[model samples]
Target: MRLWQRTMIRLARSRTITDFMHASRLMRPFSSRFVGGGDAGQAVATAQELAGEGIAASLFYLGEYVDSEKLVRENVDALLKAIPAMAAAGLPLHVSVDPTQIGSVLSWSLCRENAFRLARAVAEVARGGSHPARPALMLDMEDAGVNRETLQLYFTLRENDLPAAVTIQSYLHRSLDDLRDLAAEGAFVRLVKGAFAESPAIAHTVRSARNASFKAAVDVLFSQRARERGVYPALGTHDHRMIDYAGMVAQANGWRRQDWEIEMLYGVRPGYQRRLVQQGFRVRLYLPFGRSWWPYSIRRVGETPRNLAFVLRSMAGAAG
Candidate 1:
């Protein structure tokens, strides 16, 4: 990782910095650009708006690394409420949850139970036919420390026939193998260029290598074997090169736009997302909400310092 990205990641982890940013009036506008609102209602509204514009959404209530069972249950209950609300709004939404937020830090057993509870709630909502299609319950991948546990929880969800999707980060050396394994199980997956700062020992530290790895991973997802196994791939990226590469692969394989989906963050590259949607591609917006927006926003900025320009522009507009 670049020095600034490493520094930003460290800053994102500091409680004092997070607290200060959250408390600052100036951070509100900046935060609004990324987070939908501080509650589920706003998230659902955002999904509704996107639906009107021919886009789907993935809603995430962002808080993580829960240490208490009470907190974990609260998160699951929040999702349980959000699922029905989205269904009521008639939005086909993907609900994302961090395994740690559910219970990874407490114990694997606890995480599995909480994850199953959330997954079951989502499945029940889908059965009612309130959504356009069966909504997906996606497991967001965190740092390397919890990667194994996260994958295990995802597998368990799939074993029980839950509509679960897992994220694979291209920066990780092991992701290609993991993608193949998941494909064999007919798992749905979202592929991302990783965000967390990791040691060179475990992850690709070179940008060129990471990009190459990302392309290679995409190739595996689009391959005939993956298709035969019924693996659904969602490409989560804003890079034009990667997006074009995905389009090329789809065309060459005679895959229709609906065969796979393109996923992008809510705030980043809005115009690009719209263009893809206009071209008849399936697009899903990753919309994160809740009071835990501070850490999440900081981490996003840490991943790409260019995002700081958005904050600056928001601040300037407020000042003017």
Candidate 2:
């Protein structure tokens, strides 16, 4: 990673900094840009609006590395409620959850149980929606430290024949193998150019390297073998070049517009998202909502450190 990105990643992990940012309203404007809103209702409304323009949305309740079981249960219950509500609005009921926030830290068994529970709910909703795409309990791939457990949980979900998806971060050296393995299982995957900062020994340390890995990973995701297994890959990126590359690969594999999907943050690269949709590509907006937006927003800025300057300028403008 570049020095700035590394610094930003470290800053994102600082509890002291997180507390300060959450305590003040200075970050609210910045958070609002990325987060859909403070509740499921707002997220559903945003999805409803996007649906009018031929786009889909994923509802992500935001919390991670939660300290208490009470908070974990709250997150679980909130997601359970959000699923049907989104489906009821005629929107695709996709939800992303972080294992750490959902009892992984408290008890692996508890986490697994909750995940299976949510996946069952998703399966039921998906059967009723009749949307071409399946309703998925998307498991967000968090920091490398938590990845092993997250991935295991996803496999567990799939083993149960539940509706679910898993995210793969391309920066990690092991992702290509993981992608290949998941492909055989007919996994639904969202591929992300990873955002966490880690040592060069285990992760690509530069953007160019990360993008290179991302490209390689996409090949595995779009290969004929993956296609034969009913694997569906979602390219989660704002980089037009990468998106184009994926389109080319999908075409080479004889895949259609709806065979795979593209995911972008709700407010990031709006025009690019629409252009893809116009060209007959499936798109899903990653819409996060909750009272606690600090971690998610910080990760966004950390993913691209230059965003920090934009946030600072916005805060300054608000002050003036």
Candidate 3:
């Protein structure tokens, strides 16, 4: 990571900054730009609007790194309870699951049970939705630490005949091998250029290398053999270069736009997302909602210097 990003990350973790962000209402516009809303009801409303534009949604209830049993249950139950209503909207949808937030970091069995319950709920409701591509309960890949366990949870869900999907961080050196293995299983893989910071030894710390890794990942995920196995690749990126590269590869491999998907963040690059939809590509926005919004909002700013500058300028305007 660059010094500025490292510095911002450290700042994001501090008590003063966290508390300020949590309490300030000035972040409302910025939050709405990227976040779904402060609760599930509002999130569904946002998803409905996106649906009218020919896009879909993957709803994420944001609360990560839970430290207590009560918090874990709260996080799990919140999403579990929201599933049926979210499905009722008749939109192509997914509930994003972060294992660490639901006990993977502390207890494996507990996390598995929580995840299984959520995935099973999705499996039941997905059949009733109108969209042909079955909605999946997506397991988000957090840091490198818990990736294996997340993938295991996904397999367990699948083995039991539940609807499940998993994410792959292309920035990781081990991702190509992981993608190869997942392809054989016909796994639903959401591919991203990873957001977490890691050692340069294990992750591509620079953008060029990470971008290359991402393209290379697309080739593996969209390969003829993988497609034959019914592997579904959701390209989770906003980069035009990556999008174009994936489009080219998909066309060359004789895949239609509807066969795969382009996943973008709810608030980022709205114009580009619509353009892709108009071009007949299936697009889904990752929509996060909940009271625990500070952690997510700060990371978006830190992800790019331009985003950081924009937020800072917004803050200045708010102060004025």
Error of 3 at 17 (Å): 2.3
Candidate 2 local lDDT, residue 316: 86
Please tell me which model should have the higher lDDT, number 2 or number 3: 2
Clashing residue pair totals per candidate (backbone < 3 A): 0, 1, 0
Candidate 3 per-residue C-alpha lDDT over 1-320 given as tens digits, one digit per residue, 9 for 90 to 100: 55766676777667688778878867655666678887778888988898899888898888887778998988887787677767777766588989988897679898998888888778777766565466788999988888888888888999998889999999999999999999999999999999887889889999899999999999999999999999999999989999999999989998877789999888788899999998899999999988877777777767776777667766676777
**Higher TM-score: candidate 1 or 3?**
1
Candidate 3 lDDT at 89 equals 73
The root-mean-square deviation over C-alpha atoms between each candidate and the true structure, in angstroms, is 1.4, 1.6, 1.6
Q: Judged by lDDT relative to the true structure, which candidate is superior, 1 or 2?
A: 2
lDDT of 2 by residue, 1-320 (tens): 36666777666667898888877766678778888988988888888999999999999898888869899988998898899888888887789988887888888898899899999998888887576467899999987887888889899888888888999999999999899989999999999998776788889987788889999999999998899999989999999999999999999998887899999997787888898888889999999988788777877877775677868976886677
lDDT of 1 by residue, 1-320 (tens): 46777787777667799889888887789889988878999889888898999999988887787788888887888788888899899888479999888888888888888888888888888888856744789999999998888898888888899888999998998999999898887778999999887888888979898899999998888887777787888999999899899888767766677778999998998998999989898999899988877778877888888898988988788777
What is the TM-score of each predicted model, taking all chains together? 0.96, 0.95, 0.95
In model 3, where is the ten-residue run with the lowest total lDDT? 126-135
The residue pairs in collision within model 3 are none
Cα error, candidate 2, residue 121 (Å): 1.3
